[model samples]
Target: MKNIMNKTATVMAVHRERYELLAENHMFYGKLKTADFYNVNERVEFPTVGDEVEILFNETGDSLITKVLPRKSVFMRQTMGLPDQAVAANFDYVFITMSLNRDFHISKLERYLTVAWQSGGTPVIVLTKADLCEDRGRYLEQIYEAAPGVDVFCISSLTGEGIPEMEHFFAEGRTMVMLGSSGVGKSSFVNTLMGKEEMATGGIREADAQGRHTTTHRQCMFLPKEIVLPSGERIMGGGRIIDTPGMRKLIVSEVEEGLKSSFEDIEELAACCKFSDCTHKSEPGCAIRRALEDGTLSEKRWKTYQDMLREEAFSKERKKAMMKKIGKARKEIKAKRG
Candidate 1:
């Protein structure tokens, strides 16, 4: 029953009924106290990985999580057909890693860009396993065509090629989160950055570029002190990195600014349409339609934008319905009490 409160800490990992937190240069196990449960409107409140929380530790028992601080950003996706659940939080950059081999797909990259933009973090496109791919330039061109104005890098963990360029993002006080499907060499990349095999790596099918998912849980690791870049530049306390288990589906949720940011070119083109409410499907004087017709816009990219818009709309509706159900349930409980 430690009454002292406001012990700020960062959530490193979340497990069933238990949480791992980093506070005051130490790690501690914590559990959510009953009083910490939020009100009805916040029925979904819980600390996800990277959340900064206030806690109180009992010497002879596990720490009690008193509060979950507001998150600067959250990476979440729908789980098991349920509402979106957070995967990580408070990351400054999202490393959207994808292998340059058979796993490369323009549509998948677009989906990741949408989710990264929606997560309120800067998205960096990292094309891994460059050694396996011959025409890196082709994939680079496709990346720019799909996600314009985002930083893109092609790196090989085996040969240390292009690994030095990533050092700029690892400045102190910054955090980066790796996101992609399994077999993208995310762990390998981290190991290369760490100068050792901090994470386990698995073999992938050389044909399809698929591999067994090696990372079983989401965890954060601090970069080594005084990291030396391949360019011979030394940087101290080079930020933090969180490795998450590869996800299969990245279903986006209610994203207005994210959609606009991810598809800025499309939105700008739509602004010039003859009708303010033009859907760009079959409308006359549609700038987007003209762009698609004239090869100014890739049809595949346009379709990806449209698909994300539909998904965002659906997510918004789903959230509204869930909130309605929660409100009704609260009212019923109040009536019963009365």
Candidate 2:
């Protein structure tokens, strides 16, 4: 290992085995060291987007990523058969984008809210395509119902409405990431924020209103807002924003506290149940069921909570199974070496 003091860089993007980092006022290509790949016993470690890393700069070749610093926050998901993947790390804000037109749904927003809360980032609901929606008030009401105490904005890329409100959040030294499904106008929102068409955007499918992938991978965009005065003076203050590919499937990983926080009303009601083990399904003295039957709770919201709880439980079990398999494989390798 080289003993030279290396410069610190933040990961801009991760493409397969290669990483792109921004350091020393320039962008450089980097590759992980062999030790970073094999230093862990059972867990797999690799640099991801938004990860701050120490790098040994190379004038003629790719820089060597010497160390990955600790992350303050990470956005990740657990799929059924695949290993858990980190979508973004060390972000301060997570914008859960959803177009207010055909792509709007409270259930999906609830799911995204749980993930965002679990990610250790402040969740802000960005309702894009406000120009296309006929009744913006209706959507705002629904959003407030789904995500109480969270900030929600209805923005129009064509009219530039509600775009200025997000300027403070993107100020220098802060990082934010966008998460939404395809066709939710995430790219369009990014373009409008930057005051130019930086990301290529496509139209939604006529039949299903689904969006084709315009951005193929996760990439970080350095957004520095230029505040222009009436006398032609321009002041610049903005931060980093990362745009991730549209996620079609989002599964929560170890989100028990997130679930409780997101559904605090339901949890509070459940705590008053007569039976500690109440299933909330036709059980006597079940507070959840009582609330559902009365006008206190909506059936739809209750169902969404139950569904997410089940998914979280299933994901934890799958993670346990994967760890067991990895442990067995490592033991087998040691035995073979002996």
Query: What TM-scores do the predictions have?
Result: 0.91, 0.92
Model 2 residue 318 CA deviation in Å: 1.8
Q: Residue 314 lDDT in model 1?
A: 86
* Clash tally for model 1: 0
Candidate 2: misplaced stretches above 4 Å? 227-237
Least lDDT summed over 10 consecutive residues: which range in candidate 2? 227-236
Clashing pairs in 1: none
Backbone clash pairs for candidate 2 read 170-239, 171-238, 172-238
lDDT of 2: 0.83
**Which one is best on TM-score?**
2
> What are the per-model C-alpha RMSD values against the true structure?
2.6, 2.7
